[model samples]
Target: MKVLSDAGVNYIRIRLWVDPYNAAGQSYGGGIDDEATVLQIAKDAKKYGMKVLIGLHYSDFWADPATQIIPKQWKGLSDEDLNTEVYLYTKKLVNDFKQAGVTIDMAQLGNEITKGMLGVRMGNGDINVWKNEPYDTKLTNLLKSASQAFRESSKDTQLAVHIETPNMYNYDLIMNSLKTHCMDYDVLASSYYPFWGWGGNNPDNIANIEKMAKDKYGKKFVIAETGWPFTLQNSDGTPNNISYDPGHYQVGPQGQVDEMSAMYKAILSNDNGLGAFYWELAWIPVKAGWDNWQYNKLMGDVAGTGWASITSRGYYPDSKIMYEGKSASGGTSWDNNTLFDDQGHPLQLLMMYKGFLNGYESPANVTSSADIRVTKIFNNDNVNLVNPLKINDQLNVSDFLSDSGQEYLNGITGTKISDASLKAIFNDLQDRKQSKTYTDKDGNKYHYEFWLDGQTTAEKLNNFLKLNSGMKYGETLKVNYTATLVKDKEVPTVTSPVHVTLNKVYGLNNVTIDSPLTVGESMLAEDLANVQKAVNNVLTGAQGTTISGETFKNLQKAIPGVYNATGALEGIKVYTTDTGNHYIYEYWLTTDDIQGANKDVKFGDPINVTYSASLKWVKTA
Candidate 1:
């Protein structure tokens, strides 16, 4: 805290979650910013002699423009009841801080309340139609209620309203509505990120907004939040969100300074520009490693180090459904964007904020403690291709995890990094370079090349692994490579070659399936629940979305004559034998929906499922 205070940072913004615990009392991670947690943070910031600005989320967990889940305690609340809660809750929060001898200089009423705050329950989903209507009126009333309570509780604290993605429309709507309703607020702020910058990173747009805010609304303006990644590298194996930039700034510590400086300069354009708050400068991966998953998870659940905990899953469903993420997730996802490295050692960029006061100057000894650790090891070693690969068979990172796959050790050469998830290796391999050639048993030769920015083979995998694009029948790809890091004084050499190959053990010619009895109470293999499970787990897991299929089951029992291969080759469950060659068969999923007119696809829906009939050879083992 002194590190920031000494560096011209006089204010600290902490998010306040209403009740970040489930009924079981396990924390919901994310700083577990329940009343006690937020109060303590506020008290600590005060000890450091910095003002506190609590971004009251209103919800128990995350609330934003996209999703603002109502707090578990506030569920089933009517609009009027919710208003009362916001007032009472915020008022008590202020009074308690005072009682604890902590002063809150500023309190952001809501965290990015561009959408309906508390929860998104705007009627007819058309609040824009009537800015003076019930939806807007109720929303304003809630803010007014909170504002009244804030003023009543403490005359010392200032009220600030924050929104992200600073633009005119939402800002106009929010500010205009507030003005219309005669609801009081001191500042109208927005998060000015590079990608979501002030009118496309234009500093002039900020000046324009500042002028308008002061002249029209008579309000102070500031950038409530902003951040840029110091490096694109993942420290704890979790992917960083801000990998690309429109400004095309080089990614490193110096780059972070430049990006932040540009935004800060924009804010400083006006005399009353309160300046920008770096979103999360110290969110580093502090003492968590892959070798201790259980320990890390326990700490994450109990200490709020991670984005979420499994114990809090029931309360937070957005993470559960959005892209099928795990409920208990790790963080330091923002470790790259932090002022410190993954090891918790401060980066040279830590001094960047201090530079805003005087003139910008590079740190005298601009060095980093960061290291390139082996994150992902190849997981998909052996796979069966049921269909010839086609154009646009899009690949996913999860498809590459194999039990027997290996990765190059850091600094030296050969060692299997079993600690890394297949996801990690695949994520790292996405941005790469090198080339190779392979010839199959059929004598068909293929050559492939990797590039840093080419769609043919992006990050070593993509459309490049298709039928006409290098991949061939019975060919095992040897993806050999080596790498060295550029020292910001040091990293390691990747000397061991990562050999990756997958065999198309079964193809259409060798494998075929019959429905057994096409009529009567007939059942299709793809229609069986077990077959669907196999397709999702086995086929998609191995080949990604390219080959959509499930096991052609009820085979030996239902179609004994055709689907028989007892002349065993290893642990043979069941296979086919046109020749002595045994093969596994499966029915492919349909591309077209059973009813395309009704375009409703569940987020977790299988890649292949329709009325149309298609078959693919799934796997050998």
Candidate 2:
């Protein structure tokens, strides 16, 4: 908190949960943001000369676009009783904060209440009563009760109704629905992510939404949550919702800076746009697994694991450690998108905020599309003779069928042997009795029966060709490998390249080599080899693993004769094999900060060194 204050951050938004503990007194992992915790955080923020924005989740755990489970204690209350309960809870929470000498600058009525809040637990399970109730009266009454309590407790605190999605249509729907129910709210809050936005994150779209909220509804608008990922990899063993999608947005530190700069401009452009908050700015990597902490215990009781645990209650005798030091199910998927690195160090994005506070010009760049790389493999026999295949070639397929057999043949060989005897041999290797149907995009189905018998299609084909044909072993075959680089049409926004500058304020001694470093012909070569090993280790970890900047720096230092190194690798190129396993085959790293030598290498999983040399000796007087 002090670090952020010193860095020019003036406000901190803290979420308050009604009751985040389970029957066993275990805390849910989201943050035991109970009344006491909220008050404590508020007091701490006040000490740092920062204002507090209180977000009331109104649930024991999380409440979002999906399930909004009613607090367990308030499960069986009648509709009227539930309204009264909400009023009382809000009033008490406000009074508690006031008594603690903490002033609440803003208070959110509900957290992302797009679907609805306080879901009524039907006999079967939790259901959204707000959507089904007559005229949305129940939801209106509940909001009115909570809002009135907030006003009675502290009339000065700004009240906001939070929702998700950056689309203006969704914003209008939420506001109109509230108006129809005769509910009042002072601020309109929404969550925005460029990758998840319906039409992509357009500055114009954000500007229009802010303008519309003020003009049409006479309400202040604020982005409660917005962020971009520095890497596509998830710290936890879960899939990241926001990643580097070609044409949609760039994925890296610079990309985040660009997106954030644009967002700030859009918000500040409108007088009614209060400001935006970068969600989960302080989240950092931690050891995975369950412990006796309140949050961990709650996770154990509720779901029998940590926050990422995907298990049932009473399934395990106790919460078992899943991975690293967190839950086995998954941990923080947004860690990469955080303002800090995995090691809790501030990222380059923090400088963007500093620049904004210092009155620097907002980042300016027109959005452009990224080139999408598409790879399609054809059978060895179906190359130039039939389809005219070539590398770096573009082919428009009005009708395309992606089948196992097609991909398999492409994997083995691409061109058909022109010789009649070779063609006969290939035909003899196929299993003509078995047939399978494949459908094209146009609903046209084609039947295929030819299949080679072996451990793999490639092996079978290779064996047949070698035994019957004059092909030499280990010789390169003219296989039509087609790769297409086309501009992304769906999302046509590309961010500027990232410019990195290492101040060298931190010494290189902090670098820790995890694996053994083999002493090769040179220390630089050994370091490069060690770095490659570490990288491959991470890539083969949980799916979606990404390379970190720290790891990249360590590798550069390993290079002999290099004073400093700073560069970033392009996003990993992923391809799914026949067994449905995704693997990265290629990526490039741009390097600089050499002492006096330039090194070249073929970048891949195990980077191949094509050239190496030591820096020239410099003599000092």
Candidate 3:
């Protein structure tokens, strides 16, 4: 705290949990950061002459988009009780700080609550996964309750509403809902991680958000949470959340300085931007040994040692189960992203924040994150497009769109947005049987046909696939594509000398093998939304237009599902001994039910088995 304040840091953000105990009343051990823990931290921050911002997770343990477990005391409560608790708890916590002579500068009601907070319903309810009707109203009720409580406690202390920007357009869903509900708050805020590619891999959306918050809502915008890794190596036995991804900078101390400086510069660039908070900068692990790890676990206020504890498994809906095998003590997963090394030394990057004010470093042009949505989403991280597509390779629209946008594309809802995931969603989704095996529902074999630019061809249907799926090569472009299933049972007959009898197969009841297609998202919609949201910044589009940020993000989430036959990750087999041969052999006999290999294949389908009979010949010189 002294170091930071000395370095010109004026404020400190602290995460306040309701309770962090387990069934036996044992500490779950991350930091066991209950109210008392938070109050003490606040007092210390005040002693250091720095303002405090309390981030109420409203959960007993970790509260994020995926999991927002209400305090155990609030469990199985009525809607009224749930809404009332937020007010009572928040007001009491604020009053405790005041009574203790520690004044809070700002209070963030919820953390990374893009979906919904306190979602668990009566007798174990769910948090709102997405912003829809009743849930949105429920979230607003809590926000309204908390906002009132905070203001009642001390209006001088500003309040911030924070959400994680998984999609830049998610702002519309959350912010618009807040507006419609008339919820009052002082600052509009979000969590942005460049490594996570928040808001389409660029701070362009950040500037837009700042502009909108000031212009439309008359609120200042702040990046409440932001951080990047300095190293991929973990000090504790537990693994890190960002172990390998360097993102914009290379790994180590200098990398941390570079990323932090960049983050700072990006926020200050905008007129209404109120600056950013570097998340978990001091969250370091205890030691490298096992006994020490256990000792550290025993010291948690209850489960604050690592990202989460084993005891937190039930409440945290998803991803938390991942810690089942690792240290239940919850060793550090964030040390790589913090300011301290494994041995407890302050890193050189620790002073980067102060350097922005004191001019400790030499002049270097600072460049903010660019709109690299195309490069980040397609360039090997999510979907590898650097390798070219081949004929007969199997792929679904998921190759270029995210799973969240699938329902919209299959004629489910919304206008046709730019997408590469909807078509297969309408049909069947399949895994890569082989790179050469057609991924379209029926395991139909087909090839690449790109409609580069506006050039049309007889193969125009296939031409659209690559281009729409974000396929690009050496500056040339490709979009949209197709591959049809072979309905006929008979193709070229087997040339094998061995004869085998096959039974009769019927056609056409067709249990549409639905595509379990997952993963895809491109930047076309985001590119457009950047312009559209810049004007109105609502779920409802601009002044006269019908499109909103959500509309563009939905488009960014996907395009019409295209038949991708690019054999990039799983290519075709060239030799009989190769493992890929098995998939190719399966593709050789694919038809209308290619997706349903053994289950969908009938008793009497075309039976053809091709093998080789080789006679070795040696020639004498």
Candidate 4:
């Protein structure tokens, strides 16, 4: 926690629940995450010279997007009564913290409030929508009451409305809610999980989200809680253990340093972003598994047996890294696709993970004992395909007799298919079994099908969208396909050339070159407008929609690229001008502070390109 404070994290968030322990007074889990625990944590943070941001869960344990059960104590309260209780509880809690000398820097009225902070409740004769509970009156009253309580309790403390977003698509809902609630939050709080960003970790998607949040919500925002596990003890190679707390308590850790490092880089590089807060610091690897800290350290409870050597400070101890090197399950198991034979020996599989720099190869120690193998052979690797049982044929969906297939004989509706159609479809499937193509009885042929190696749902959808418009049997769709085999692989580099041209000159002072000036945003605006006008002109003339795509592609090819030469890779942005010259070229180069270079570029500088007249330049701005 102090490390977090030293890293410029000013506020510490503590979630409060009405009752988080058992009836017999036994502690539940997540050590003192209850109200009393929260109070103490707040005081401790204050002692360390850090500010506190108290989060009121209003539930006994946890309340999130799925579970927002009202606290048992607040069960029978009417909405009106609930509003009053909230006000009083909030005020009392703030006052208690203040009196205890733990001044709150901010207060989150609720947590991840994409849905109503308090769930729907019954009133008068109908279910209360919160906004429409008492016919719109009580809803406003409830929000106003909560906001008023926070404001009146501490005038200097900022009120933050918290929401979780591991992706960009759900932000519209959050923005709409903030406006609906008329929330006067000083900062926007978000929870980010890169795994959730693109159904799996995707750095490009992460970049898109950073751009989206900063561009959409101009207010200061912080990654309220984001952490990745460091251990692999569950499915998908994640560490998820629920046994520690018997019934209600649960815990796990999976993507640790790699994920954390990525997020750290993102926050630091973001233009309108604050830092992040790793959730539940105590639950971190250093404090779990054993009672005696020394024993835990020795047995590797906090350090795990894997961390016996090394300083135990730089990311992980030597034991952890060495253990990972020896254990097959150490590194992410999701990357393992090497097939094994009946004898449990490794076989090269059709799918192979080609490391970024090295040639794809199976581990030297990996082996398979299976016999009677066939290889599908993806890319360079001639990996073996095998079934543990003696199976001569492929157990594909097509193998199930079409006549007896569930789709042909609809079990749900009991609809029957004609024999002729079944026979034709079966023949089609048999004919094209080698290729992935499928055809229906109607003789409609769907071309070009490829087996997708295991990928996230989001990746599958993106692949389908990029390659073809639709997916179904007997649907002829023109498509292009691009896919990556391994998880967390970087996208292939893409660089395209840009062409610049100059047309007629404008005035003496403000040189009106014929070339399109795709400079700042204003130039983009003018370019878009003129490009549409050119398209409209073409449509009104002889050229039809046949060449519209090509025309548009050419027109937009010369977009400006911003070069950040100082960075490892240059930052390139492309822009297009409207009606510029064709062959005649104009050159302009702009720069900003190139260290140790002769040229000193500042905010704005004039760079020009000169060309001769008699240029019959078509309207290309």
Candidate 5:
């Protein structure tokens, strides 16, 4: 918090989880932002003279558009009970912070409450919980309760209703739904990521959304979370969520800086635009521990020294809260997007932000000029060199002539060359030095300087002719010159690519065999062969075939008995016999690990198959 505050960051947003502890009272491993953690963070932010924005997840774990699971204790409650639970929970949380001398400057009612929060999974099947309620009663009730609770807790703290896809292609459906039902928010916050957000490549649409929210909804517009990755390589061995596409935005530090500048400009363009917050600016990578490979010898082995031992606290049997253990073999996915690198070193973007705050402007446009002079080169021994070569007269130059020299000669001779083509040739010439040479019909050699020696074409031609032969009978030559001045200028547009490695698969859904199998039955040898064949087909499919998280899910769906499939670090472990390493490596892919809001894969990407599993039949009463 102090690091950010010193770096000109004025606001710090902290997410709070409700009852992150399991039934055994063991806390979840991912920061477990309970009351104590929230209080300490708020207090630290206050000490650092930074405003605080507290985000309520209203779940024991991460909450977003796809998953908004209800807290364990709050499940099966009636509408009235749920409303009361929400009100009391929010009110107490805010009041507790107030009593701890940490005044909340802003509060997000719910984190990315796009599909409605407090979702309860019915039985073991997927069902629409919101559809069960009439007129969005449950959603509005929960929002009203949470909002009223915040108001009752503190009158000064501003309230914001957050959504993930306001500027997305489905803006009307989301915003209209919210406006029709719930409209008690002081700030309308939206998440905008250039690589992930809807129409993110187009800044005008985002600005228009900001203006629309302000003008139509009468609410202050703020970009709640936005980030771009410098590298696509995930710290964990899995593929990165965000990838760089040349058609859209550039990648790396300069790309990040430029994107930030453009976003800031767009935000400030609107009248009621408050400001933008960079999401997870301080989430640097830590040493490997539990689920991390640096300290642990194997997955789920917590009884080891170093970072693993420290991370083992959450999974200890005697511990109050027992966190579900994960293999500590991977690293943070957002480390590349953070303000600091893995070594705690500040990145170039940190200083760029400082410069932005200090009112530094981007570089100015550059303008330059060049003189092009053409000299008619002829042989003094030739009788046809009377009036020198006139305009539109073909020079019959050698095929070895430089393109720029040819184009310049073409331009001087009244031959039409499009401005675009001329500019392209000029730009290429300006990029580097070039040389051109020509010989007359009399066997005398004449050299012309297109760019080398910094001499004009006419000067080089004249100097060669004057030094070799001056008005001689058989060697004398008449030189005719035409001075062509060209001017060029540009506003200095720059671009770069941020490369990200991705694990892609193809034909993942083609797993089928001759025999039918039961869901709970053990897999036969033929089934395994079919699975291998399907995977091999994907491996040997079109070279550039790419897959997405949805595709992985569909692959699971295609195989009747197979529960899941994922990319492995070692790739297809069964294809060791193939000397060419043709096997596609993969592991069991989960929704939590795949690209949540980002785009899909590209062509020719090799996939990693880590794990695949078939379901086992269970006897139930």
Candidate 6:
């Protein structure tokens, strides 16, 4: 609590499980964080002068994105009856906590609730797993009951609907479902651990998350629980020799601090963002309690011996790093600002072509002519054209005027009119002394095609040339073009085979392919088959404009592949036999220790899995 309060963290979330003891009447040890335990934590936290948020895990045991096991007491209850139980449980917990003199600033009816809690139901409760369903009757009843309980218990305590780390795409579904159900949640709470969720800091994804939360909830957003581990251990029960740098994600005190700083920075700036809460300080390493690796061994607060490292580490406060405030190191330096070209990417400026005009040499004869016209002038990036008369439209260049604009506009390669053809056309037009419209091979319309006088102003010539190049006939050129748009033509973008990797294992048989039409997105296997169906549903007969980011990411996740596990890491090591030394690194979560031990850890049981090393392979040949 002090660490958080010192770090500007005001609120703490403590989870509560209902009757964590089992049907067999076995009382799970370890406090089980039951109602009694939650109240105790709340009391302790308030004594420390910290705000408290009670996370009500309605189940007897753990609940998560994967499992929402029914509470032991509620197991025999019917679907309709379960809803009442949820409401009563929530109301009782809140009232009890209040009676205990603990002010509950906020309450989460469920924990990390990507899917709803108390998932099993009596009738129509089973979900079509293939569909990767939204809240069905069972989940709806549970949520509705919980929401009612929170609402009825205390109007002052804010209700937070906690979900998995914000995936801009899936978060929409959660918010939309809540809105559709009219579930009243005061704050949008999410759990974000970059290493496990959302992969890493993807700016596009981060921005999407901000937009989705602000747009959907229109309420304050808070990170309910988020933090990184400082130490990592291999599955083999050995300490990972690799150490983290202070400044990055490599794994160390500084890296954790940096990550926290970055996360806070991103969140506080979000208009709808409220604040964040650290998980638990009790889990911090201590000398006389559980083993160092019992929970968050990487945490210095838990590892009491390493208190100095954490206390001394500099944490750049929110007010200082955010809102344009600078650091003591002479303020921030923006050394990497750059301009993007037509494709909306950083442009690498380069001079590919340059043409100079020799001071006009008098034409010896009336017909001693050159195609004296400006053709194409490409920007340094070569992605954008810088001609004075360039077209401004989103359609393909071919859809615009002819003049071979199709070849020059829209990142297309430009072509120069052949010297012989230019001369012949110029002579014919000059003889006729007429201007006529012409349609180019690309089907663009050009009017008043041809050149005017050599003494014509550059502005007028530039305008005339814009259309003249596409005209069938117009004023003939008396002089040759001093600068013609020349290009060492290369084709536009070509599709490259997109490579996808799954951070976790998926069965080959469990995988299903969908959306055979859209080339960019295809779902492979082991994914909720419905996701593939969703991909196919959106992609089929849909134009490029209709394809969404969700559909695209789902397809990426669904790419069919099998992982080969070798060595004694209990299938945690995946290596492709063909690749000499390349392997996909993975860390798995197991319940064996937590389950085999003296406790029936409830749903939303906090567990930490750390990466020790990337699988290494050697050349056998």
lDDT tens digits by residue: candidate 5, 1-621: 667777777788888888766565645545657779878988888888989898888876667776677887898899889989999999888778877888889888888876677773333223433344463566767887888887777888888888775544445454555577764668877787777644554568778888777777777877788877665544433223464453355666556777777777888788877777887776554542122332122221232211122232332222222234533322344656766655575655666666764465544322121233344322233432224333333332322234443433322122243444333333333211122323444633333222311257455444434433322222212222332221122223221111212222332243332232332333234434444445443333333334444455544444222221332223322322213322333323222322232344433443322223322212222
The better candidate by lDDT, 4 or 5, is 5
Candidate 5 to truth, TM: 0.52
Candidate 5 lDDT trough over 10 residues, lowest sum: 494-503
User: What's the distance in Å from true for residue 279, model 1?
Assistant: 1.2
Instruction: Name the candidate, 2 or 6, with the larger lDDT value.
Output: 2
Report the error of model 5 at residue 299, Å: 11
Q: Against the true structure, candidate 5 has what lDDT?
A: 0.53
Candidate 6 residue-wise lDDT, 99-173, digit = tens: 888878888868866655676423342343212443354565577787777677677888888877567656777
- Model 6 residue runs over 4 Å out of place are 2-8, 23-31, 120-135, 197-204, 233-248, 284-621
Where does candidate 3 have its weakest 10-residue lDDT segment? 368-377
What digit string (tens of lDDT, one per residue) describes model 3 on residues 1-621?
787777677788998888787777765556778888888888887888988899989988778776677788898888898889889988898888888888888999988787677863332334333456676778889989999998888889888998875454667666777888999998887887778764453576677667767777788888788777877775665657897764567777777777667666666776777777888888887655332344344343244566566666555544564535543436776778887767666776766666764446733322111110111111122222324453433334454334533333322122233344424322232211112322334443433322212234323334344334542111212222332222222333221111111121112132121221111211123322332343222223212222323443442223211112211111122222222222211111111122222232222232122111111112222
lDDT of predicted model 6: 0.45
**lDDT agreement with native, every candidate:** 0.57, 0.56, 0.56, 0.42, 0.53, 0.45
- List where candidate 5 sits over 4 angstroms from the true fold: 120-135, 168-173, 197-201, 234-239, 243-247, 288-330, 355-358, 361-621
Steric clash count of candidate 1:
9
Error of 4 at 34 (Å): 3.5
| TM-score for each candidate, following the candidate numbering | 0.58, 0.53, 0.55, 0.40, 0.52, 0.43
Model 2: per-residue lDDT, tens digit, 47-107? 9999989998888766776646678789889998999999999998889888878889998
Tell me the lDDT of model 6 at 122: 31
**lDDT for each residue of candidate 4 in 1-621, tens digit (9 for 90 to 100):** 454454344667787776654454533233335666888888778867777777777666556655566665677889889889878877887788778777778777667654555654344223323344343444345556767877888888876666675555555545544566675666667776554444523445555655665677655666677644332332222133321222111122112434544565665566766655656433323223221222223233222222122222222223333344532112112111112221222222211212211233333221111111122323312322121212132334433234323232221122233344333333332211223333434443332223332255445345434443322333322212221122122223322112222333222242344343333312233333332343333223221112233332332232222121111111122222333422222222222111212222121221121221221223344
